[model samples]
Target: MPSRKPSASLLDSSQDDPSPEDALALAEQAEAEAEEAEAVAAAARARARAIRLRNQAAARELLAGNDTEAETSSAESTVTEQAEPTETAGAEDADEAEEKEEEATARRRRLHIPRLFWKVLASCLAIIAICALLGASGFMIWKHGQADHRRQLTAEFTAAARQSVVTLMSLDFNHVQDDVKNILDNSTGDFKKDFEAQQNDFIKLAQQSKVVTESTVNAAAVDTMSDDNAVVLIAATTRVTNTAGAQQQPRSWRVAVSLTREGGQIKLAKVEFVP
Candidate 1:
């Protein structure tokens, strides 16, 4: 048997049936899309309104200049001034632009540290230079005084050198005991160890140390110094007792003695011998 031809009713039912439910669903979908679109449009308008307010504030700040004090006071007090929609949208743009510029200027000022550092550095260097000059002057004065003292000491020693040294054969006194001492000194005069032997004789005499009429430096002949040490003698003379030890003999000598200075004090160094 031939299949029944597709009836008009069957064909109509296959087109998902012309039902009210489908129409209702389409209506609900259209309403939801309309609500979403309206929300999005409202958001866009809100953002535009915000931009407009900011630009208006910038415009006012620019055009206002230093207007009347009362006008400025009123503008500051009027909170509604910003909330009120401007007739022109320029106020919103101006506010945001000025805010960015002011922030940039503040950032520039904060980052520029080199100028302040240079100013402080210059002041410090000036102070250091002044201190150095003062220190140098003080040092120079100290050095000059020290040099003067050294030169004076050298001069004194040079003048005293000739008188502190005398012939080994000669004794400052002429007593019998001193006579024998003189003979012994003369015997060692030409001795091979003349310098050492003379010192030994003087040391023996110094041990006995008889005042022997008071002996003074007669002459000094040598100048000796080691590093900072110096020697000098100023004056010399000789006197001696005779056979009875009562009579006196006198001799005059221009003399200087070796003196060493340590820590600014003059010390007896050596008896200078004159040639």
Candidate 2:
């Protein structure tokens, strides 16, 4: 019969049912697609891993460079700080050395002044000593000369007094004129004038009395002596033989003799007898 318009269910069931070859081919296609998808996913994962590894390596390199820069900066700062201290020490040392040199120079200058002053003082003292020595020597020479002159004056006065006493007391009446002349020659000043005024009388008396006298000086001493005048004390004993004396009689006489220097010669100025 119209074969019945074939039932829809059958037709549909036939369409749903696949052939063996077709089923096999589909299974193969599905498996192939799955395999392709698996391959693509694996490729993507490999690419992402490679990219991450590259980024990590780049970051490590940047960090190493920064550490190196920091270390270099620290080292430079340390070196600079150390160098600053060394420079300051060197400057201080130089200043100390200069100060010491100045102090030494000042000490030398002070020492030099004292040495010069001592030398000048020593020279002055030496000059003063020499002058003092010369003055002392001159004084000694003057004193000795004065002592010698005084001694000579004393000797002269003594000798002159002795001679005058002997000559005046000793006389020879036979040569009365000559004896008188001798007395006159030795006499000067007041003694010479008085004796000359009585010269004739003395001659007459000596002749009439026939007087012969001998005299000796017992002692003579200088009482006062000066440059131009002197006084002498003369003690003498005289033996007289005359008309009034009967025989030879001894008489003691003490006479004060005054003398004056005339042109370096001692002459009698006066003769006085003392009781």
Please give the range of 10 consecutive residues that has the lowest summed lDDT in model 1. Answer: 183-192
lDDT of 1 by residue, 124-221 (tens): 99999999999999999999988887667666555434322333323543253454444343332233245445655665664465435445554443
Candidate 2 residues lying further than 4 Å off, grouped into runs, are 1-96, 243-249
- Determine the C-alpha RMSD for candidate 1 after optimal superposition of all C-alphas: 18.0
Q: Evaluated with TM-score, which candidate comes out highest?
A: 2
Query: Who wins the lDDT comparison?
Result: 2
147-240 per-residue lDDT for model 2 (tens digits): 9998899999889888877888888899989988888888899899999999999999989889899999999988999978899999999988
Per-candidate Cα lDDT values, in order, are: 0.54, 0.78
Q: What CA RMSD would you report for each candidate?
A: 18.0, 26.9
- The candidate 2 region of ten consecutive residues with least summed lDDT is 1-10
